[model samples]
Target: MTSTPPSPDAISYFGIEVPFMQHIGLRPLLLDSDRCHTLLAMRPDIVNSRGDIHGGTLMSAFDFTLSGAARAHDPERLGVITVDMTTHFYEPARTDLTVIGRCTRRGRSLAFCEGEIVDTAGTVVAVARAVFKLVVRQPA
Candidate 1:
């Protein structure tokens, strides 16, 4: 299937050298303002014991994708630290998967985001929500 190309903002936010993303072959698939969301994909090697995708790995992917969406909305001199995260595992992810993260709300110092992990067959494998602390960067 042909997927939509990622926005330039997505590429700028996720540097090519990010180790965790690179190790799993995670890539940005789509970013759309109409949906107020971003989509990310990961190949199957990111699995754990029981031959299912590791929860932590999936969480990390969700977190990263949420960050990308936040940054895409506001791309000027900001950094984020995750304050809290909650995830629900619905099914075992056996194949490559896609994560769609949407910004539910954004405040001066914080942002609320949620993401869903969907397997290749379109099964919802996981859901997650997180609060991120946004910090304004200072010039040296």
Candidate 2:
């Protein structure tokens, strides 16, 4: 299905106000029923020794973006926790990165998601697949 960029309100709807997201300047650009997209600007603090974006940084974005997609499958906005994830690094990212995630399947209690990170040049730098467990947590 086609996915458009998320409106500002839609980004907030997905709850982008988190410490880690803020620290890395992660911006949720798109949010739809089965898809989500995010952008992370290149920063010196998040780069590795070789001056490329760190793997952990990309993984965090993947996890969050994937969960956002999975959350769309839940009308109640139930909490989703990553149960397991597998990521593959294809190249180093030297510029801003954009991540796209899609929920492949959603069950009553679990969801499967896939995501890819692309560099400023539109080259995919990494890919990830993850499983998340959907749960209803008591409000704080």
Best by TM-score: 2
Which lDDT tens digits does candidate 2 get at residues 1-140?
56455545433536534557767778878887899898999999999999998999999999888888888755355778899999999999899999999999999999999999999888999999999998875544
RMSD of each: 7.5, 7.2
lDDT of each: 0.69, 0.84
Cα lDDT over the full model 1: 0.69
* Highest lDDT against the true fold, candidate: 2
List the pairs of residues colliding in candidate 2: 6-30
The candidate 1 region of ten consecutive residues with least summed lDDT is 33-42
The TM-score of predicted model 2 comes to: 0.86
At residue 85, what lDDT does model 1 achieve?
A: 85
